[model samples]
Target: MSLNESCGVYGIYVEDGEALPYLYWGLLAQNHRGHQSHGFAALSDGIRLYRELGMIPALSGEELKTLMESLPGRLGIGNVRYTTSGSVDRESLRRNAMPVLERGSRRSIALSFNGNIVNMGELRSSLGLPEGLSDAHALNRLLLRALEEESSIQEAVKLCMDQVEGAYSTVCLIDDGTLLAFRDPLGIKPLCHGCGEGIKAFSSESVGLDINGLDYCGEVSPGELLWIEEGSLHRERVRHSGRRAFCAFEFAYFARPDSLFNDRYVYEARVQFGMNLAERFDDIASRCDIVISLPETANDAAYGFHIASGLPWEMATRRHRYVTQRAFISKAEERELILSRKVNILGRKIRGKRLAVIDDSIVRGDTTRSVVRRLRAAGAREIHLFITYPQIIGPCFYGIDMATYGELIGAWRTPEEIAEEIGADSVNYQPIDDYVKATGLSRDELCLGCVTRRYPTPMADEMAREMWERLRSSEREGGRIYEG
Candidate 1:
C-alpha cells in the first residue's frame, strides 16, 4: 500500500533582501508536518529549484551561506512534503517532491502545496494531463492551465478554485517574481499570511510566522486569493462557498502546540480536550493512580488531565531528543522500529500503578499496541487510554493518511473491542461535540469528516458514501477509494 503524508508549505517575498532565508526558517518551524522530503524554489534568473528526500537539513553558518548563494532571490517558496496522493517508494518520492516546477504554454511557475485533491481522476482526464501526477503537481498544472486562459492571475486562481474538488492551501512563485497564495473554496486546510519589515510571507501554520518574528496578519480567508509583487499586496475573495471546513484533525494531532488556530493556541485546545475527558470519565479518573502522557504531543493534554483529575502527572515516557522521526508518519514497516526507539519508559514511576495514558489519536492499532506492550513490560498495573480526537470511523479524503476503511480500527471495532485488542484497561475517546467546543470553532467551520463520516466537499461526500456502502458487507477492503 502507498502511504500518505501530511505536508507543510512556506513562501516569502522580500522587497530588498533575499527571501530564501526567511523561507527556510518558515519551513523549519513546521517540519513536523512533513518528514519525508524538503525542497525550495526561488525566482532568480528563472525558477531555481533544489529538492532532497529527507527532512530539511540543519545548516551551519557556512552551509547556509552556500545555500543562499545557490538560490539567491527576493521571491521564494518552499515545502516540507508528505505524500497524501502519490507513491512512497524512494524514487517516486524523490520525483514527486514539491516546490514542483512546471512550464505551461505561456509561463513557468513553481508551487508548494498542502492538502489532497479528491477528484484527481476526473481532473486529469478532463484536462488531458499525464498519469502519475501527485495532487500538488496536478494543482500546479490546473493553475498553469487557468493562467493561460484567464486575463489575470486572480482570475486564474478563481478558475482553479471553481473547478477543483478538494482542500488546497498553495503558495506559488511565478517566473517573473510574482508571489501568489490561495486557499480552497471551503478552507479545508490551514494557511495564513504575515509580514515583518519588508518581508511578506505565507505559511501552513502561525508558528512559522512566529519563528521569524513576523506579525500575524491574519488567515487567508476561505475562497481568498492573494497576489503580491513589487512590495504591493492584492486580495480578492475568489469564490464564496458559504462555509468553512478547516481540518479538525489539525487541532488534535497535526499542528505544533504553539501554533495559533482561531486566535487560540493548539496546546490550549488540547488542554480543554483533557479537561473534557476528565469530566466525561470521572469514574475512570478516580480509579487511576497517575496520569502519563504519550510524550511530546500529548504532554499538555496530560497536564490538563492531571489538573482536573488531581492525579500526579508523571514524565515517565521520555521521548529521545535525537530520535526525531515520528512513528505515526513513518512508513508501516518502519513505524515499529521507530516507536521502539522513540521513547524510554520509567519503570519505577508506573510500576504497580493504575495509569491513565493520554494520547492524541489512534488510527491503526499497531502503534498503540506497541506502546501498551512497552508499558506492560515496564510493570504498569493498569492502562486506561484517553484519546483527544473522536473515533475515526471513515477515511479522510482531504489530506490525512487514513485513506481506507480497512486501515482504521474504529471503522470496525467498538472502544471496548479496541481496548481488548490493544491490551488496555479501557479506551476513552473525546466526545465529538466536546472536541468541537474545545477548538472554539462552530461545527460548520471544521471538517469532522473522518470522525462523523460526512465530508464538507460534495465529491468527497459522494465517494465516501459509496465506498462505505460497498465495504460494509466485505470482509476487507484495500486501496484508496478516491484513487480507484
Candidate 2:
C-alpha cells in the first residue's frame, strides 16, 4: 500500500506583466501532488527556467524577489515532480525536474507534464533518444518533431494525441505568447482550466485555481486541446477513445479534498466512503466505541462513519503542521521516524476503547502497521482498520509511484493476511463497485487498473500483464517494469 501522488502541472496566460506570481502560488497550493522537485519555465523573449531538487519555496522575502526577477514573462508553465518516471537518484531527479524544456534550431516550447508515458520504450526507439531522459522530455521531443512536420500547434498536438499513449495532462507555452493545454485521450490525470478578471490558467487541481482566485471553468476534457490566445479560449476534441479512464485514485487519495472531480468535491466523496463503510459493515460498527482517523485525509470519512454508526469521531490523532512531508515518498529508514514525528495519539481517549481507525488507502501497509503499533502502545483494547478505498491488488503505471507488483501488499496477500501482517484485529476494505459509486462516476469513466488490473490503455495493459507474470515467478526484476 505504498501511496504516492503523481505530479502537479500549472500554467498562466496574462496579457503582459509578471506571470511568476501566479506560477508561484499555483505550485505552492498544489505542492501535495509532488514535493521531490519543483520548477517553472517562463516564456519571455526566450524560455527561462528555475527548478530545484526539493519542495517549492515559500513565496516571500529574497526567494520571491529573486524568483520573480529570474523568470519574468506573460506566459509560463510550472511543474512539481514526484518522479513517477526516470531515475530518482539526486543527479537524475535534478536533471529530470520539469517543465522539461527543449530548445531547437527550428523552434522551441516549454512543457510541464503530469502523467507517465506507457509507450516510452517504443517511442524512444523511433527517435535518437537520450539515455535517462524523462517521460516529459520524451513527450516534448515528440511534440517538437510533430511541430516541425505540421502546420499549426493544433496539428502538432493532434499528432501527439495520436502517437502518445497513457496518462498525460500537459500545459505548455509557445514562443508566440499562446498557452496550450491538453489531456491524454484517456484523461488519466486531473487538469482543469480557470479564468479570472484578466487571466486564464490551467492547473493540476482546482485548489490551485481557488488559491489564485480563478473561477473554475471546467476540466480539460479527455482528448481535448485547449488553445488560449489573448483572452480567447479555443477547444478542440483532438481524439476521443470514447473511453474516459479518469484516475479514480485521485478522489480516494491524491487530490486535495477541496478540489472538484466531476463537479463533486473530493471531501464530499470521502464522507460518502465512510457512510458506505458503516452501512456495509454494521457488525464492526456496533462493536467499535470510537472512530479515529489517521492524518487529515481520513478525517472526513471518519466523521461520516461517526454519524452513520452513532459512534464518537475522536480527534485523537493530531498532525504536526511543520511535518508536511509524506512518509511513503521518504527514504525507507527515515519513513518510520517521520511517521512517528508527524502524528501523535491522545492516549487517554484511545485507552480501553474498541477503536475503528479510518484511513484513505493502505498502499505499502507500513503506515497502517505503524499507526496500529502506536495504538497498541497507547493501551487500546482492539483496533479495527477501515479502509476507504478498495484494496489495490495491482500496480499503477499511469503516474503514481507504486509501479511494481512486488511492492503492493494487496497484490501478494489477502485482507486477512494484511490484517495479521499489520497487527490489526480486522482490516476492512471498501468494495470496488461501492468505491466507484461513492465517487459519483461510472466504472467506465474511471481507471481501475491498479485495483482491477483492467487498464484503460493498450501499452499499460500489456506491461502490467508481463510484470505480473514475472512477479508471480518471483523473478528478480529491478527498476521500473514500465520504463523498460
Candidate 3:
C-alpha cells in the first residue's frame, strides 16, 4: 500500500471579512500533507463550496481568479485529502470530499474532517444510510441526524462522538458566523488553533499557522471542543480518559519537518529516533566501508546513525522531486513499478564497496529489492541493510492504510530469508525496546499497533480475522510476498 497519512484540514473565522486569500495560503502550506484533492467551503449569507481531484498547483491561474471572484464569505474550511480508509473512485471522490454540507433547523452546517472513524461501518448501519456510503459520508449523515434530534450543535457533536470510534480531528462551520473544532480522545491526528487581528484559524498542522503569520495558541486538546464566533472563543472538555496513542509514524516518516506536534518539534523527534537507532545498531556499524541513506525519510536517521556510530555519510541515491500527482498513488502496479525507476543510484559511491544502506522500514519489500538490485548493478561488493524501526509484522487499523499483515515483508519471512531475497549480505532491524525508548514517551503515549498485533482498542475477534483474510488476499494478488 501507499505510505501516506490521512488528510489535512484548515479553517478560518474572519471578523473583518474576506478570508479566501488567507485560506489559500494556509492550504498551500499544508499541500505536502496531501496532494490528491483540494476543496474549500465558505460561509457568509450561505455556504459556497468548490472542489477538484488534483493538486493545489493544478488549479490554473484563471480558475483561481474565477474562484476568488465567485467565492462569497468571510469564514471558510479547506481540506487536502490523501484518502486512507476509502476507495478513490469518482463517486467516492465526489461524496467524500470535504466541507460537506448538511441543512439543519433553518441553518446549514458545513463540515470538514481529517483522520478515520474506525467504527464507521457500525455507525452507517445504525443511521440506515446506504451500506456503501464511505466513512466520511457516513459521518456527515450521522452528524445531520444528531443535529436533528439535539438542542445545539455542540451537544450534537458530543452525542455523535458517543457512537463514533477511531481517530478524528474535525472543524464544522455553522451558518455564517460560528466555527466548531475538536480532536479525538487519543489525539492520533494533530489539530491546532491560532488567532490574529480579527481572525481565528485552525489546521491539522502548525505549519499553516506559521505560513499565515498567526500566533500559535496550542493544540485542540484531546476530546476538547472549541467554538469561535463574533471574535470570542469558548472551550469545553468532552472525553478525558482515553489513552493518547499518537501514531509514531508521524515523527518517523509522515509529518513535514517544519511542523510541530503535541508541543514537540517533528524534525527534532525524528533526529532523536535516528540517534536511538544508532545506539541500537552500533555494534554492526563499523563493518561497512560507507553509510548511505535512502532518500528523504531515512536522511534524518542516517545523520543520527553517523553521529552515534562515528561513520561518514554520503547521498548515494537520487530522487525525482517533480512527480507529485494523484496518478502516482492510484495507478496500476505495472505503471508504478516503471515509475520506481525514477530513483537513481550514484555509481561511484557504491562501486566495489561494502556499503550499509539505512532506510526507515520495509513495507512490502518490493522497493527494497529494487534498490538492492540497482546497488548491485552499480558494482557494490557487499550490501548490508539497516532499518531504523522494528520489523512491521502486523497491519495498522487506527488510521494508517497498512491494515493487513500479509502485505508486510516481515510478516511471512525471516530476516535471513529477506536478506537472501533482496540480495543483501545481511539485514538488521532496530530493536523494538530501543525504538520505543528513543521517543522519550511511554507505550501509552504512542501507538505500536502496526509493529505489534496488540490493538489499543478492543476490536471484535471476527472483524480482525476478516481484515487479516483480506490482507492475505491482497498480498497474493499483488505477488508481494513468498509464503513459507
Top of the candidates by lDDT: 1
Give the clash count for each candidate.
Answer: 1, 5, 0
Q: Lowest summed-lDDT stretch of 10 residues in model 2?
A: 475-484
Off by over 4 Å in 1: 1-5, 475-484
Give per-residue CA lDDT, model 3, range 211-294, as digits (tens): 999988998887788888776888887777467877776766667767887677776666766677666666667777788887
Report lDDT per candidate: 0.88, 0.86, 0.74
Please, what are the lDDT tens digits per residue for candidate 2 over residues 1-484?
Answer: 1112368999998775678889989989998988899998887778888889888877666778788888988788899988753457898888788887876778788888888887777777786677777778888988888987899888899899888887889998877677899999989999999998778899999999999889999999999999888768889998878889999888878888999888899999999999999889999889999999987889999988898899988999999888888887666567788899999899999999999999989888887889999999999999999999899888888878778776778886889999999999999999998899999999999999999988998888888898887765554555433322
* lDDT per residue (tens digit) for residues 444-481 in model 1: 99999999999999888988898788776453465333
Clashing pairs in 2: 1-362, 1-363, 1-364, 2-363, 2-364
| Least accurate 10 contiguous residues by lDDT in model 3 | 326-335
Model 1, position 73: C-alpha lDDT score: 91
Clashing pairs in 1: 5-83
Q: By TM-score, highest first, what's the ranking? A: 1, 2, 3
- Looking at model 1, report the run of 10 residues with the lowest lDDT sum: 475-484
Tell me model 1's lDDT, rounded to 2 decimals: 0.88
